[model samples]
Target chain A: MNNEKIRNLKTHAANIRKGIIEGTYAAGSGHPGGSLSCADIMAYLYFEAMNVDVANPKMLERDRFVMSKGHCAPALYAALAEKGFFPMEDLKTLRHIDSYLQGHPNMDTVPGCDMSTGSLGQGISAAVGMAMAGKLDNMQYRVYAVLGDGELEEGQVWEAAMSAAHYKLDNLLTFVDYNGLQIDGNITEVMNPEPIADKFKAFGWNVLAVNAHNFEEIDNAVTQAKQTNNKPTVIIAHSIKGKDVSFMENEASWHGSAPNKEQKEKAIAELDALLKELGV
Target chain B: MAEKIATRVAYGNALAEFGEDKNIVVLDADLSKSTKTDTFKKKYPERHFNMGIAEGNMMAVAAGMASCGKTVFASTFAMFAAGRAFEQIRNSICYPNLNVKIGATHAGITVGEDGASHQPIEDIALMRSIPNMVVISPSDAVSAFEAVKAAISHSGPVYIRLGRLDVPVIYNKESLDFKLGKGIQLTDGRDVTIIANGLMLPEAIKAQEILKEQGIEARLIDIHTIKPIDKDIIIKAAKETGAIVTAEEHNILGGLGSAVAEVVVQNSPVPIKMVGIEDKFGKSGKPAELMVRYGLTPENIVEKVMAVLAMKK
Candidate 1:
């Protein structure tokens, strides 16, 4: 992401935030906080970095992305719909019955999704497996996975982390949505995963700290990851919970609660202004 | 004739034969030597992966390989393939219904000297609980070889539970039909039906012959696929015979017996007896001795059949 692309991503980031609020508000149930936080990282990957065919989602050589932080599904769904994986009208179906835009991402129902993922801490392992498969097949494609800061408490996640480093899967890139909030409370107060970068570094991954909200920085990190031939990379992205919405920003209550009628008006107002300011 | 051949060896032989297709890839967890996949590993090292003892990763890696249209056979111990990475098998493989064959050696008490820790008594139960998972146990090396060949040709996730030690070669080397999700009935009898699978099938066959000597005609069916179990056959056996006996090299519960019983008691109620390891973990010993002690031999199947027959009367 250079200066010109970053400008486009800034607009995408704002539209994605608006999409999150409007879609969840329509369904009356969703997690907006983490979605808001992860929007920019996802935007950067989808728009500027990943070597994926937006037309043929099942392309053999296409890059793969797995959202391990599944609660932030609203953000991904918004981005996917905007990218034309499905109808933009489907955004109204988030968490609804018989909807392709499931509350959680399911690979069977969604076209662009590489794997069905909802159980936290497991998706990253799948991404590692995909990356390993890429190496085995000698495919040029890479794999990217996103994890929640709170979901790191799972033991299986670390088991996968250890194995990923052991295999020297350089084609793998993991992003942690360090939003500092969980469903119950702040992650530090619940089960802290602070000093997260050190834990991954100890496991032999090349850890890179990034401003997840900045498209340029994230794109640069991904470009750097491709050059390193023998080691896997983990980008610990620092971000605000509920990034763009004024009332929801840094609030744990927004974890799964959809905005009520009055709250929706306020949230939409904030995102609309942000989108306009970014000229989208 | 009690010629011995290990299930793991038969597995490697089966894969070696499957190598002629050029699509079958063998993946292992550093247990290629133990799982008998080293033969396949040597032939197609490009297709085989020694994921270095990482069971969960191997399973997930197998799933990825399958997603790309390759027929992958991941070999490891039964305890690890069906136990340690149960979810990986469920989510990554079975959920999407990938074509991955899990050749797990050291299943049941048959892998005796490995101790109770390594023996996978609960493996059949665990895999049977999963949807779209095929659980097969070959009674002998000949059938084990055939089962591996069948699994490679079959589409979807198949769990081939094998043993570490050499067992008897019961089936004829020339030919025996062993397709997925179907049972091979060995003999015809109206008096009782003996259903057995995996390491216990040979014992069931032996028991059927013994029953015949006593003028008792017992039906024997080798259940190679646990999921999509030959419900139609088991149902007919229950309705027509009224007495059924299930033998396995697994725990009495959640194995073939329980899976059969679940169908029998529901659609067609019958007196069914289960012959297997009854709730006790096995210890280090010779494989034959352990099989006999665990009551998984032909003698135990006969006893269980008699008990169920008594209930029918």
Candidate 2:
């Protein structure tokens, strides 16, 4: 929570955002809006919060992260590359036929991906499983999962939520990227998953809300989630559809579209200016 | 005749027997009693997880547990486990090639009064289509027990189909060699070959007796492992017999019959007949009555054998 740490994380977040735009632009397809929306959270977790080792990606004791909203793989891949899990140059090969970095996070092919997940709702269930595994094995590893606000509409998410509470998986921490906009427009108009925190509360989760773009609030919510006991915690991080990029920010159309050459240049220039402001 | 035991009961007993291993875990989706996983739950409460009525979540949970070095066995009725949670089984378990065994009971029309809604007549076909998925339909209680053991030892996703109706125990447990992808030849003859799995094996055996009386020496094979099927044995049988008849308590379109034909036609061409439900659903009735109505009896197997033999030049 120090100023220096906040500045470092902000720089990392901006770089991750640039990487998201670069990958999506290069691939000519991807969920960029949601990916950019979660860049800060992903940066905070991989760089400051998670206990993963860059050298040994599969270490048994390392904390696990599952991208429940797997369409936002550009954000996760950027964070993993930034954390030295793989090379930064590989981001350009995002969804190519020969590339290991698949359109969705595949654990078998990707180094830092804990589970292969493209389908919504299934990732949180797998995260609950990983948390249960840590508890059953008497290991200290914790599990973290990030879900999109629209992704909460899947019934399987609630099923997994009920199970995490039933099994008392206190070791699990779930984050909902509440960007408010989905592919079809506003989430409320598409399929109202409003009061997401209240729903998780009803399901016996320790619910916390934070400004998803703020490094301090993100850290504070994660600290509180760690302190919570006897129940799983859900940090409902309020985020914009696109966090830093100006033309794409808050636009529902950007939810799954890649930027054109000019748009990519503008987004990268904006991210570079933000990184410079952070004094990185 | 040996004592009859339901394959589900055998599955439960095998789970309990395997519970002594520290790494083995059992999960069920609120149907432990019907699926026979309650026995394992009773013995090892800590290792057992009752996933409530959510079959899809149970599969992914088993996949997660399997990923963390636990030999997980998830049980539910075949209809829910194979049909309801097909995508979960494919993506979470089979796609990852996790060490999870899906022991689904109440397979085929033998689920009886529950009718087509509960009976999973196409589970083998559904499971066989997935990559890295091993499908096994144990014929009798002894082989069902051994199938559980084999599934645990083999590393990858496996679906073990168990029946609700009691089947006459054919193999002696002491002498049973239940290896993965290995077929068990119960009787050897030259006139025709009968490939059967699950509840149809006993009927195939009975049909063999009838064929003997008619001066047709029939060969009988209990195809316990349906996927990664014993292709060598199937090709050998086709070459030696020149005719084949496949029987099962499932749809004729895609079960043991389709699987055997895929191998036989490609490798060793032979005239083949399939004795099963003729691409129709079952109605509420007694298991025996449903078997007769669906043309899944010894008589039907004999008729198919006769028809197949006639077509064999």
Candidate 3:
């Protein structure tokens, strides 16, 4: 990717981060840390990688994305908002009963969400199903899903991994946001899903790795995944728990804790600085 | 003896017949042979997916395909379909209200030799509790086959509980009138109503005959659709008959009996007796011996009917 393109994607990520902070802060509770961790990847997917239409969200041939680690729905909602799937200002209504933006990604209500997912490990299976459907119909569209590293403790993830490879779903691409920390603590301490690349490889998947924050690396991995035929690809996206915010960086406490007024202002101010630097 | 066919076999036949629809997909969790989904797999190899032994993944996968406009039928033993993969069915299939039909074979004590671990006596309860989930327990082969057709025609998640035992075919194609949520009244009487489903329908029929012999007329109803249960039929039965006896091969706590009772208590409120496994698990035994031991026989239904009739005001 070109420098200007990368810079543009960075601005989208910053805006997504700002939206995530605003959303979780307004809701008074949500997993902001994981949402922040995957903001850049979400930006790359919505703004650059996936072929989705905001106007015709249910287009037959459009690429589908499932937020498997649905706790990070703030990131997905933000990405969708930034990409003009819905109004960006509606991000503040997230997790509220009256708002369509639920705590989890409900595909029925959310304009761009391809699958309803909240319970961990099930979204990848849905993505695999979508890929299988695409193959059945001989469609050119692909299916993408994102999972949290901590979410790997679920047995269904491996089951879905096996199915993806068993069926040779090359059209399916998955990413594990390896942000290290979960709500309990560091995933290694809680439940080690380390050796994630080897595990997926063992499950007959074509495995890749990338810095999730780097749009270039993410783009390259996506290209490689598309190039690889016969086997589904999984990208181990190494990311900080909280990427841009100062105090929230690497903090497990922020996993499900909503930012207070001051914390929200500080987080937004940091993201605003990044936006200013990118001349957005 | 009348023609006997297992509901599971009927379910398999229905899938194979329905495979004529290009968009209909079948998935099995490594129990195609037992669950009888192998019949569909044999005919439409490409359309059928063997999802190994992972029922949860199969359900979620089925949901995904359904989301993409395919009518996906996911089959497995009821133990795994409703018990092991309850959460997957809840969050993935039912919550989204996808076009997925779950053919759960070998439900109840009729699973016999496999014992409690395999028999899913609580499946109907587990399924009906989830919103957007339609639960069906067919009385015989014909109804089971027709229920599959109904499930396909009706969009959203549907759970069809099938049996391992070969029960008597109560209805043939011409005589059967199968609708999604409507219960079929096979016989009408005024003394008491016998509400039954799955393998126990034949028993209820036999019990009705015995009641007639004893000079007590009884109504026989096949309560097939357990979730959006036919409240009108149950309420009408309660009002007219003034007593009810629900017979099933599952636990009395949550199966046909509880469903019928829920309707009767809310709508009409009558004296009701449930003839089921009495909240206990099944042990390794023959289907016939297990049915007798668990009080899922015609004699048991008659006795329950007599007991319920006595309670009627």
Candidate 4:
């Protein structure tokens, strides 16, 4: 990982961590373990990779991002707020009655949210639709989606993966957050998709395996995907269950459960220091 | 000769005609031939998308296109469009109030030999339950054409329930009487009101003639729109005519019958007799025979109207 991109990515990741802690703590409920795991990738996409205009969130040709694993909505809502799509204050209302920051992303309610998603295995299909539409419209923008390792157990995800490969959607980029744990325990123990890369290859996709938390590897993977002529790319970024917060990292208990006031304070302190080191 | 036309064919013609303006796009699940959207694919190749049997993805894709300022018409069998993709329709389309047209075919027992599995007897109930969904079931070829046009012209998510068979053409070739969410009264009578939709509209008309022979005055209402269901017309018919009989080629549970009952029972509390397929699965037969077996014939409407009249007396 290069020094500059790494610093920028780490800074964004720390904020995403801060965003998750604050949003979930305020909402009193959310999926934080998965959110923290994708903090780095989401940060990398929004800050370093995606070509989008924050000023015109509805720009027709702007790049699109779909959070296929929508249970981790806190990560996305925080990223979008940080991007100035809405007031950062709105994240405090997560899951509250009449809150635009919902438990799942609603395209109409939340600005810059490309589609409404919460139903597992359905969001990627919507992302595929977006990718297909961009191709049909002859738009130059790319479409990227993030999926959870366990959330991939749903059959529709494979159905969409097969279709994307068959159509040769080169502009589509998908990230599988290879966090071992789901809501219960280890994904391998529950429902193992061990040969996931092979599954993608069989479905005709270009596959890559990398450390998701490493910005240089993620950035390099993104660059490689862009070079491909006519195949949808899948980057299986190996990630921990709950990343960054020392005590919480790789822990399954933090999956959907929010931290207590004391635990929240300790995690926020660690994230704040991490941001300071990156000069954010 | 009343040339035959399936609702799917009428859908393709009307939508293709609307595509001329460049704002409409057709999204299909690879059943374009069965849904008669092949006619549209021929007209505007760029505007039509054959997504190859992915009905759930088709709904979300239509919603995406709708978000990008294009009005999308998604075609599939009624079972898949309404039953398979209900959540997508509810969240992406109806919840946001997007302008996406869901043109579903093969509804009711009129699907005939396809039997219960391919047929969607409960599509109306599924669609009508959504908050902002506009549900329309045109009675014949002419109304199907107009229903497609009206769906595109009007705003929001519209579910156009269609049949797989060639029904009797009831409208004059030049009649442009299609309006959004309004009841079109076909006949007026002081004794009873026969409210009908889809394949049952023709049967209701036949029942009107039969009631006349029996010296019983009957009003016939063509209730094409089931969601913003013509409340003023239904209330007036019930109050002035004394009783109402609802007839639909759908399950009596949550389709047109339930919709009309909700209105009549709340506003007027007039006696209502619902004529439709009861709580039972459908079987393979000729469309005519299946209609009788499902109790969707004109004779069934007459009987139900008489039962309602007896209750009123």
Candidate 2 C-alpha lDDT tens digits along A182-225: 88989999999878878999999999999999988999999998
Candidate 3: misplaced stretches above 4 Å?
none
Please report the interface RMSD of model 4 to 1 decimal: 1.9
After TM-score superposition, the amount by which residue B238's alpha carbon in candidate 1 deviates from its true location, in angstroms, is 2.5
> What are the candidates' C-alpha RMSDs?
2.2, 1.1, 0.8, 1.6
| DockQ of predictions, in order shown | 0.48, 0.73, 0.91, 0.50
Instruction: Give TM-scores for every candidate, taking all chains together and pairing residue i with residue i.
Output: 0.94, 0.98, 0.99, 0.97
Clashing pairs in 3: none
- In candidate 2, how many Å is residue A8 off? 1.1
User: Residue B297, candidate 1: how far off, in angstroms?
Assistant: 2.5
Error at B120, model 1, angstroms? 2.2
Give the DockQ of candidate 4: 0.50
lDDT (CA) per prediction: 0.84, 0.92, 0.92, 0.86
lDDT of 4 by residue, B14-51 (tens): 87777787777888888888888888889888888787
Give Cα distance to truth, residue A146, candidate 1, Å.
Answer: 1.2
Candidate 3 residues A205-228, lDDT tens each? 999999988888999999999999
**Which residue pairs in candidate 1 collide?**
B137-B198
lDDT of 1 at A216: 71
True contacts kept of 2: 0.52
